[model samples]
Target: MTPHHGFTPFFTGDSYISPASKPDWLASALPTLTFYPKAIGVVWRASRQASSGRYDSRHWCESSLNIVRSLETVGCRLRVTGIEQLRKIDRPCIFIGNHMSTLETFVLPSLIMPWVEDLTFVVKRSLTEYPVFGHVMRSRNPVVVDRVNPREDLKTVMNEGGKRLAEGYSLVIFPQHTRTVQFDPTQFNSIGIKLALKNNVPVIPLALLTWAWSPGQLHKDYGPIIPSRTIHFAFGEPLHVSGRGTAEHQQIIDFIQGNLDNWHRQDSD
Candidate 1:
C-alpha cells in the first residue's frame, strides 16, 4: 500500500540518530508490551501485500519505517551514519556485512531503498521459509542458499547473484555463516567479495548492532525487545573489488569489528 507517514523525509539526512526524547511519553513509562506487537503488525500487513503481489520496495520501506517507529516509541534509540555512501555509486553493488540479529533484516530497507530503488538480499533458504516474514523475503527475489555447503552456496550466489546485479538490483549479503549476537571475525566469509569481484561491482561494507532485539532463546528470529539497548547501522565507503578479494574481504571484517567495539564501549560508558 502506501508508505508510512513521512517515510520519504524521515531519513533524508546523511546520518540519523533517533531523538533523545521518546515520541510517545505515555508509551515511555509503560513496559515493552506493545513494542514487538506494533512492529510485527506492520510486518504482517506487508507480508499479506507481498503474498498478493502488491508489495515492492516502497512497501518494504514503509514496513521498515514503522518498525523503527515502533522501536523508538518504546525508547530504543537508533543511530545511523554514512547514509551518503549509498549515493556514492551510480550502479548496483554488493553490500556485505556481519549478521547479528533479525533487526537488520527489518530495518535496513528503510535506509537503503531511498537511494537504491532496486535491492534484494542474499539470505539463507530458511529465511525464505519464515512464516509471514518469509513471504516478503521471497517476493524480493533474493539469492537464497541452504547455508549447509559452502561450495554449493557460493555457486548459487555467483550464478543467481550475477543475474540480479546485472538487472540493477543491489544485493545485501551477510557473509556470517551462522547469525550470532556476538561479532566473530573468524566466522565471516568472503562470498560477497567473490560475488562482487566476479560481477565487476563495488562492495560496500555495512556495520550494524541490533542487540536491542535480543536473539531469542527459543525462536531465533522472534526475540525479546530490550528498549535500553541502542541500535546502530554504519555504512562504509565502497571498495572496488580486485584480484582475489582477500584484502577487500578483510577490510569489510575490520570495518564491522571496529564499529562493534566502539558501540560496545559507548554503551558501557
Candidate 2:
C-alpha cells in the first residue's frame, strides 16, 4: 500500500457488518484455540507495515477491519448502528463510552474510522510501550496517559487531546479506569466530558456490548472467543457542551446505562 500523508475516511456497506447467521459450537471452539496466534500474527504484520511507513490511512483502517473480520470467521456476531449521527458531524467530537472487554479496543476502529478519518484513543501510557502493538498504536498518534495520578492524567488529556482536536482528529475516551464485564456508573468518570467541554466540542455518547471477547486468565487480551455473545455498538447524537459539564456527564452515564440494560435484556430473552 502506498503511504498517504492524510488519513483516509471511506467505508462500504460491508463496513456496517451484521452477520447473516451465528456460528455453531465446533466453529466457535476452533477460533477460541487459534485466536491468540492469529491476533499476534495480524498485529505483527501491521506493525511491520507501520514501521516501514507503508501503513498509511487506508492500510490502518483496512488492517483494523481485517482483525474484526477474522473474529467473524470464528462465528462472532456483531451489530453496529448510529453511523448517520457520526456522518452529520462536521467537526471533531469526543467519543465517550463505558469500557467493556478488550474486544472493543481491537474492534472499534473498524466501526468508527470510516465515519471519522482522523481518529485516535486516549489510552493508558503502558499500551504505547508494548512490543509490536505499541509501534502500531504510536503510529496513529494517540493521546497517552498514566492511570495513576488522576490530576496528571487529566492535564495530559486536556493538553494533548486539545492539540489533536485542533488538528481535526477525533478522540475516543473510556471513562472507566479499567475494563470489566459489568458497567459501574460510579467508576465511569467525567474525564471525556471535561475534555469536550474544555475543547468546545460535542460529546458523542457510545454504548457497546463487546463481551464476545472475554478476559483471559493469563493475558487479558488473549481471552476465550464467545461467538454466541452478539457484539453491539451504538452511537448517540452529539451533545454540545454547556455551562458546567455536570449535566452532560450524567447524560452520558444515563445514555450508556439505558443501552446496556436494553441489550442485556434482549440477550437474556
Candidate 3:
C-alpha cells in the first residue's frame, strides 16, 4: 500500500523490524509496502477522524511550540534574538533564511507565529507526497511548486505567494534552494528577493544555526535534552525594495550576505 498523507504505519505496530532494515532504506521503502499493511491503514483512518477546519494560525502556533518542547527533551536548545524587530513592523514580510538542517522546518513557526497571525511557506512538491507530514503541510495551504519546471514554478510562486501576502500572511523562503552540508555562496539564488519585490513586501533575512543538531546519525535515540548545544537565530532588519532596477538585485544579495556575516560574527564572540 502506498503511504497516503497523514497515514503511515511506521509508528503504529510491532512489525517494525530493526536489524532487518537499514535506516536510510527503511525511510525510503516503508511507504511502498502494500501487502498486509497495517500502519498505513491506521494512519489514514486517524486522519479521517481529525478535524476538517481550515488551517488555523493559532493551532499552527500551538503545534510548533509543542514540537519545540519535545525537541528540548532531546538536548536541543534554540537561542533566538532580534524578534522584537519583527513586532514593530506593521506589514506582512518575506522571511528568507539559510537552509541547513531539518530542525528549522520544525522550529521556525513557533518563533514567528506569536508576532504574525498568519504564516505559510514555499515547499517542494515532493514534500506534499510525504506520509503524515504531507497531510499536515497540505492542510496548512503552503505554496507548493514543481521544481522541475523553473519557469512555471516561479510564476506559481509569485501568484500564490502574492495572494498569501495580500491575505496578511507572511512567507518563509529558503533561498539557498537546498540544504547543504556546509554553506556555499555559489548555491545561493535571488528568487526569494524577486518574490519579495513582486509582492512589494519587506524582506527579512534570517540566519539558522541548525548544525547544533546533527541529523542522519546512526543513533536513533532522541539525544540529549538539557545543556544541549545552543542554536542561534538572528533576524535582520527588513529590507524594502527601493525600485525595480539593477540596484534592487544588488541590494538583495547584500542583505542576505551581510546578515549571514553578522550572525557568524556574533556566534564567534
Using lDDT as the measure, the top candidate is 1
Clashing pairs in 2: none
Residue pairs that clash (backbone atoms under 3 angstroms), model 1: none
lDDT of 1 at 128: 90
Across 70-155, the per-residue lDDT of candidate 3 in tens digits comes to: 44433345566666556655678888777876667766876776666468889888777876656666766789887787788888
User: Each prediction's Cα lDDT score?
Assistant: 0.86, 0.81, 0.61
TM-score of 1: 0.93
Error of 3 at 205 (Å): 0.8
Q: For each candidate, what TM-score against the reference? A: 0.93, 0.91, 0.71
Runs of candidate 1 with Cα error greater than 4 angstroms are 1-9, 23-31
Give per-candidate clash totals. Answer: 0, 0, 6
Clashing pairs in 3: 1-33, 1-34, 9-39, 74-224, 75-224, 75-225
* lDDT score of residue 108 within candidate 3: 80
Sorting all predicted structures by lDDT, with the top scorer first, yields: 1, 2, 3
